[model samples]
Target: MKDPVDILSALADPTRLGAIRLLWDGEEHCVCELMRKLGASQSRMSRHMATLKVAGLVIDRRDAQWVRYRRNPALSPAVAAVVDAALALPVTEKAEEIAA
Candidate 1:
């Protein structure tokens, strides 16, 4: 398991938070999809995904020429609760707002 601080630190970034939300449904999303939704450049989206991967909040697999990411399946109950709670909050602005 990753250190809690490292995981929390990764979540502290709004860009990462947004990406996490995108994967909250447990569905895998291609890097291009995330970029399109967030109106971000490929480099920026990939950078944040890399951060989530390091923190163990997400997993990535190469799908042909694309990379797809999904929320980590082995989250501790407490960590899962935190993620759920965060996602439950009403979005005053789309998280993608920060992604751009």
Candidate 2:
């Protein structure tokens, strides 16, 4: 079986962690919202998002031309625990600025 720590490690990236934090706070967000919030390019955000999806930390839904992401509530207990821990961290300045 794949190690859950590996999944957590994938989320440890600042960019990916920011994405997850945004989803946790907002429940769901679109690519554009994330791009603006993180001040990251579409390609960069997409790559991070794809990693999160592959790690099972987030899930995607399509709405017309937009793709929305949310924390995967059904994630494995270990993965969920990691997410919980991450959410408890001090929100980054960029995240806070965007959240305001």
Candidate 3:
């Protein structure tokens, strides 16, 4: 909300970055899928997504029992560029391990 720095800082964590990377594909994903992808517990994933919401990086919708998320359509170009750059980097060890 303050600046691009705030968005970048929110993504500084492994889990948050990974979550954003998954959403960058342009499809909405439920919290359950995010938890599975990131190898995080439900509460942990919720917290990370909450951080994303507060930073204006993602948008969410509730579908009965599920909550789905996607990259915020209204995201600033500068902030979107930062997310794109972060995802372009090689996968982190933790990410690889989780995928494996």
lDDT of 2: 0.80
lDDT of 3 by residue, 1-100 (tens): 4476778788888889888988998899999999998899988989999999989999999999889999999877877888898888998797677544
lDDT of 1 by residue, 1-100 (tens): 6888888888777777888888999999999988887777899889889988998889999999899999999988888887788777776465647755
Off by over 4 Å in 1: 92-96
Clash pairs, candidate 2, are none
Task: In angstroms, give how far residue 33 of model 1 lies from its true place.
Answer: 0.4
Task: Please name the candidate that would achieve the greatest lDDT relative to the true structure.
Answer: 3
Pairs of colliding residues, candidate 3: none
lDDT for each candidate structure: 0.84, 0.80, 0.87
- TM-score of every candidate relative to the true structure: 0.85, 0.79, 0.90
Residue 58 lDDT (model 1): 92
Residue 58 displacement (Å), model 3:
0.2
- Name the runs in model 2 displaced over 4 angstroms: 91-100
Predicted model with the maximum TM-score: 3
